[model samples]
Target: MSNDRVLNICFHGVGEPQRELEPGEDVYWVTADRFAAILDEVSTWPVPVRLSFDDGNASDVEIGLPALVERGLTAEFFLLAGRLDTPGSVDSAGVAKLRSAGMPIGSHGMAHRSWRGLSAAETTAEFDTARTVLAEAAGAPITTAACPLGRYDRRVLSALRDRGYTRIYTSDRRPARSGAWLQPRYSVRHHDTPASMRSGVLAPAPLPARARALAVGTVKRWR
Candidate 1:
């Protein structure tokens, strides 16, 4: 992927059915499985970003997958092991649907705990358990993780390497660099317009050739 032209955009909470929250109550509260149809209407740019969701929601299979399949688009989901069989978590039927649709689910963590404050052993346990559980559910190698709440340090990185995680996603706004495991992702929210979505994904790099693209993006963000 061309670092400048390509982007990585991901959605959160596309799992099970849930009520929509009141405005201003939450920032990015998309219902877990219902976003697939909504995304169908979105006009993809030439250099599309990788789409992803967090918290393996049941609707991912019921709603999200059909939409993605129709459009020939796909997404990745991060699963929380502790929530797998509990209320509000994606059930066995839901997970099977996701696999059948060809979605790649990764680990979110064992309990959705903050990874930054945990001891090395605690972090390792959390990562390993979630990875194992999600992999078994998805029936594939769960080799990546989106660090819980986007917090990580050297110790967490070490733990990931030891546990054999191959990719790591973060919420950092910076563009990704080559060979960097901490791949940055842009989060979508309720207020973002389609135009704003385009600008956010195509984060312009500073160069003599792309000055106008950068200016247009800045203006779009303020509108």
Candidate 2:
């Protein structure tokens, strides 16, 4: 509950996916009722909480947006440039709608591939082209990104920084410094419930545990 720290929660698909899910992707898709309940829980947290949705799922605008609006909450949505307009995913119109609704849109890259160790051409496609496509769709500058699959390395981080991304989110499941350029987030998954989230995320970690988590993040940054 320290003012210097913030809880960043991330969501993927909600309910049934309209299009075919990637292998192991179903684990991140939560039931509609579960999503609502989790939102309710987070809304009441005493500490600062930031919300974000990834993968450009159609459910983002369909189900997620309305629920967030009902609670007077807004979340950042990361869009996949390549997946736009495809079945079950948020299209260009949906991206525009989110922007109009006061939701910030960030690039989730051209494809949903990991950002770690990408070749030069792949990096250009993922970072430059995807940001261009999403900015056009959102009608605003896209200055933030969520690493695809929450995978990144030192090189990936450096590339994003050099590309002028103001913020980059990762699914590291740890509380993050509020002003950190590279923010870590706890991703809500299929089996996560309000109780589990409160105990696992909201509760303060012991000093030793916090150190271990920090160490893990350091290792990831350099490995």
Candidate 3:
């Protein structure tokens, strides 16, 4: 990756266990701790981009936190207010620990629902409630949010900006450019292997054949 191609890496649903809700069905779950190990490796790249984990799951505190601590790295965790079981979710104490360790907790909206079909009042309520819950839990205001499922329209951005959210993120299958409340993010999948990760996140350079190889080698190490 060149100096300009540093990708902003973020993980979704870390350490948040998923159950099939029915027997004989497949299930998917990624633990925060296991994902943190991945972050540790990716974060060592020459250009350090922002690292973030989505959804306020118990595993975030259990598995993901320790890895960040070990690597001396900090991340922003987004919370879904209504879906969060207050006690099991990152509670006041858990947020305190994250803050003490230099991590910031953020909001992921209420109920992980899309704001595309909602009215203005409904949109405000969704943003406000999640911010309230996470703010109370973290003892600090949350000014950033990642749209659940990356679904949004003009109204969504307007509501967030009106509510004073300066940074808004989306998992909209594209690379992020510094923009006004419409930052794009690449969602790292559970099935991604080391080789796939390098190709997806690293950008190719415009150097000679040998120089390109060197750039890719150096960038791969960071991945």
Best by lDDT: 2
Name the top TM-score candidate: 2
Per-model TM against the reference: 0.78, 0.91, 0.79
Q: What does candidate 3's lDDT look like per residue over 81-190, in tens digits?
A: 87565544555666777877889878888866777888767676688877898788788888998887678888788878888998988876555554445677666676
Off by over 4 Å in 2: 205-223
Error of 1 at 187 (Å): 0.8
Against the correct fold, how does model 1 do in TM-score?
Answer: 0.78
Cα misplacement distance, residue 197 of candidate 1 (Å): 1.0
- lDDT by residue for model 1 over 91-199, one digit each (tens)? 7777878778788888888876678878767775688777788778788888989886678888878888887888888877555653666778777665555556546
The root-mean-square deviation over C-alpha atoms between each candidate and the true structure, in angstroms, is: 5.3, 7.7, 4.1
Off by over 4 Å in 3: 1-6, 15-28, 31-37, 86-88, 178-180, 204-223
| Positional deviation of residue 42's Cα in model 2 after best superposition, in angstroms | 0.6
Tell me the lDDT of candidate 1: 0.67
Q: 7, model 1: CA deviation in Å?
A: 1.4
lDDT of 2 at 195: 95
Poorest lDDT segment (10 consecutive residues) of candidate 2: 214-223
Candidate 3 lDDT trough over 10 residues, lowest sum: 19-28
lDDT of 3: 0.67
Please report, as a residue range, the 10-residue window in candidate 1 with the lowest summed lDDT: 16-25
Model 2 scores a C-alpha lDDT of 0.91
